[model samples]
Target: MSLLTVRNLNVNFAQRQQPIEALLDINFSIEPGERLAIVGESGAGKSLLGAAITQLLPKPGYIASGSVTLRGKELTQLSPKQWQEVRGQRIAMIFQDLMMTLNPVLSIGAQMVEAIRSHTRIGYKDARKMAIEKLAQVRIASPSQRFEQYPHELSGGMRQRVIIAIVLLLRPELIIADEPTTALDVTIQAEILQLLKEVCESHGVALIFISHDFGVVARISERTLVMYAGKIVEQGATLEIINDPQHPYTQGLLNALPQMALPGQRLNQITGNMPSPSERPSGCAFHPRCRYATERCSQEIPSFINTDVSIAACILLEELVSHEEEPDV
Candidate 1:
């Protein structure tokens, strides 16, 4: 059975009584022990998807439509009290900001123990033991000593380790990690990514990784979804999307990778910025920035169509296939 399912999900912001659709008909699913990455430029709603799933949408913004289901349970219809049961127990979120996950006044042990005891009926002593175990599982040296230290006392990497340890305390079934390694140094970033993958695999936890870095996604996730302006432009196996991107946006993202260029050469970059939610275009969100865009693309939104490898939202799949005889662009 699927671990999680999202169908026709929509999010909107009420701006001066006008509804600005932030996320439009989003849909996807993840299987048990699968790692799926959601990649896109900032403001493309990568983080919003995570927030929506956890019922953490910011003020003035709400889920406009659709459902979020986990193991056949409709999360959208659940009461706040019921959602409280699901959040941080069945499904946990590791936020981008470590500070947000840790309380400033609380020591790492205190914060972790609170998280554990909130969901489970364990005493403080048992919860502390569980926290130390998770810390060790994430490869933290001297887990007991680290537990007594405060969040500010640790380095960026150590702080992240504590954050991961806290989430894994209950061994949740699913984890939503939104740019969890973005703030760390390159070496630390790689280590954390690997640690997350290893820990999740050992525990059979499904992961939804939100990131804009294709390299990170390629290394840690088997499947990837490319988002643009709150919509999934393409989704498939990571290798398929990396080696053979179907949508123009996905193609552009892969092409813009630094590895795609020669040594010392200027890196490729996509032209134009992702449109703001208030300033979104009428039809296809990426049409204004796409080189392959035609008049039809600017006037009519594309439907998600199944290619041989990926399901892509693009009107020019036929044209792209016909021109497949030529070299890849």
Candidate 2:
């Protein structure tokens, strides 16, 4: 059975002048010990999806449609008090910004101890011990020393490691890590990715890794889902999506990668910026920037079509493939 299942989920924010559809018809699932990556540009709502599943969407934003289930239990129907029990215990989130995960005013020890006490009936000393052990597990030197230090005291990588340690403290069933390595250097990023992979495997914990870096996604996840303007435009096995992206948006993202560009040439870039939720296009949200877009693409929304390779939402998908398959005249 899937550890986490999100079905037809839609999210909206009540803006000052209008209602913004932050996420639309998002659907996916994660099995125990499975690693899935959500890749998209800045406004694609990856982080919002993570927050929604954990029942922590920022204010004025809410699940407008669909359901979220964890371990067969419906999460969307849970009370806030019930969610308090579920949030860190069943699903923990390691935000992109490590600072957001830690309390600046409190020492690491205090925050970790409080988190443990809140979820489990553990004594303060025992919680501190667990915290130090997790700190060591994340490869932080001087665990006890680091535990007593504040967030600002550690380097960016170290701080992120501390947050990972805190998440580990809960021994969660699933973890939503939102670009946890983005702020770190390349060496540190690789180390952090390996650490996450090891920890998840050791615990048999499922992972939802939200990232814009396709390379990182390919390295860490078995499956990948591509989102654009709050919609999942394509999803498939990680390697398949990397080797053969179907949707134009997905192709654009792959082409924009530095490795995909020729040497001494300008890097490929997706022409336009992602549209805002309020300013989203009428039909296919990606139509404005999609090179293969047709009049039909601009007039009608595309539904997810199963092509045996990947599930893609693109109006011109069949035509695009046919053109590539047709014999030259």
Point to the candidate with the largest TM-score. Answer: 1
lDDT of 1 by residue, 1-329 (tens): 79999999999998887899999999999999999999999999999999999999998889999999999999988899998889888899988898877888889888888888888799988888889998898899999999899888988899988888888887789999999999988899999999999988988999999998998899899999999999999999999989888999988888888899999998889999999998999788999999988998888888887889999989898556657768767
Q: How displaced is residue 11 in candidate 1, in Å?
A: 0.7
Q: Each candidate: what lDDT? A: 0.90, 0.90
TM-score for each model: 0.95, 0.93
Off by over 4 Å in 1: 319-329
lDDT of 2 by residue, 157-228 (tens): 899888888888888999999999999999999988998999999999999999999989988999999999
Model 2, poorest ten-residue lDDT window?
A: 316-325
In candidate 1, list every pair of residues with a backbone clash: none
Off by over 4 Å in 2: 15-18, 320-329
